[model samples]
Target: MSGIYPFLTPAGDAARDARESAARELVRSTAAKAVESLELRLRVLGTLGPALAACAAAMATAFRAGGTLFAFGNGGSSTDAQAVAQVFRTPDRDGGRPWPALPAISLTGDAALLTALANDVAFDVVFARQLAALGRPGDVAMALSTSGGAVNVLRGLEQARRTGMVTVGFAGSGGGRMAEERLADHLFVVPSSSVHRVQEAQTTACHVLRELVRAEPAEA
Candidate 1:
């Protein structure tokens, strides 16, 4: 059989090679951007050590006083809120010794309440209304927002403050309005613009805080 057909011209072969190189470079650039984003998140987490420590201390104090934890967020952040609640509510066992106690509630878990509030009052009142009904002094309210500007989360924080709950906010990109408005007693800011990076850092922060609370001795 005849040899495989060659390019019609030298220029054609060169053009094809250039296009392939460009495609490869594009892939590489995209991968590099993703890696860089993760690296930035790691750096933000490292920088948040002190803030996380403070949050842990506050949580420890609250738990010791028999205070519950209330969490709220929007969209993906709502999942994070539920995760935080579960982390605290579930007992961690290593060998025979059980970890310290953590009682947490995610405001987003009740679909009935959410739908009722959203339909009757407004979306922004879902969490706030719950806080008014269920929260008590000495409890803690943990709010999550990728943009740190979700109106519903803000309303929850407002209600938390009025009810004397300790307010904690997980926020990204300079903590947005939460940072500026001083809405949180402890605000953990992940300093990235990408939602994925912020979310990863937020998860890490929550786990760290939970572990810290778990490390403390149970109240007498």
Candidate 2:
């Protein structure tokens, strides 16, 4: 059996052991990176306590005034935008008191409209056009951008501001043009160049903002 099976030989066994050791090391290194990223997110979120609270209060006020929330983004951020809308539209009931389902719409959800605008006009105007059509004063506009320089995202924020909506921005890489121009009424920057880590931190921020908004007492 030893002669027929390569794994029964000493050389084969050594090779197998080397492969297993490499795999273990790879897993260890990857897991360590993930842990480091998670710690970064939690630490940053802790440091942003006051800003988060203020942003939440603003959002809660908008909701109380019957304002709708419009969330938009591109690529992975688009998915995050949808997640943001879903979180507000159907809040989690796992906690002490269930949150009310707030009105939220994802600008990236309508493929037909997005394509129509992109094809007919310009890609940069897709979100801006949507806001012009639907957004109102006192409404909330939330946008996410990893580099914070997406043209369409910037345009959307501009439109929101022009329409008197409360603009909220989730951005990474030192907030890029979004912070430079002071576009958002409330801007949360993750301070990371890595897209994955930035998105993860943004997701945490979104959940925290939702909780804080829900905690605010609604007007009688």
In order, the Cα lDDT scores of the candidates are 0.87, 0.92
Q: In candidate 1, what are the lDDT values of residues 1-220, reduced to their tens digit?
A: 0124243223567867866676688789989977877787678668887888878888788888989999999999999999999989988786778874468999999999899999999998999999999999999999999999999999999999999999999999888888889999999888888898789878888988887777666763
Best candidate per lDDT, number? 2
| Cα error of candidate 1 at position 148, Å | 1.1
Residue 96 in candidate 2 has what lDDT?
Answer: 69
TM-scores, all models, native as reference: 0.83, 0.90
Ten contiguous residues minimizing lDDT sum, candidate 1:
1-10
The candidate scoring highest on TM-score is 2
Per-residue accuracy of model 2 over 35-108 as CA lDDT, tens digit each: 97898799879888799999999999999999999999999999999999998999556466666799999999
TM-score of model number 2: 0.90
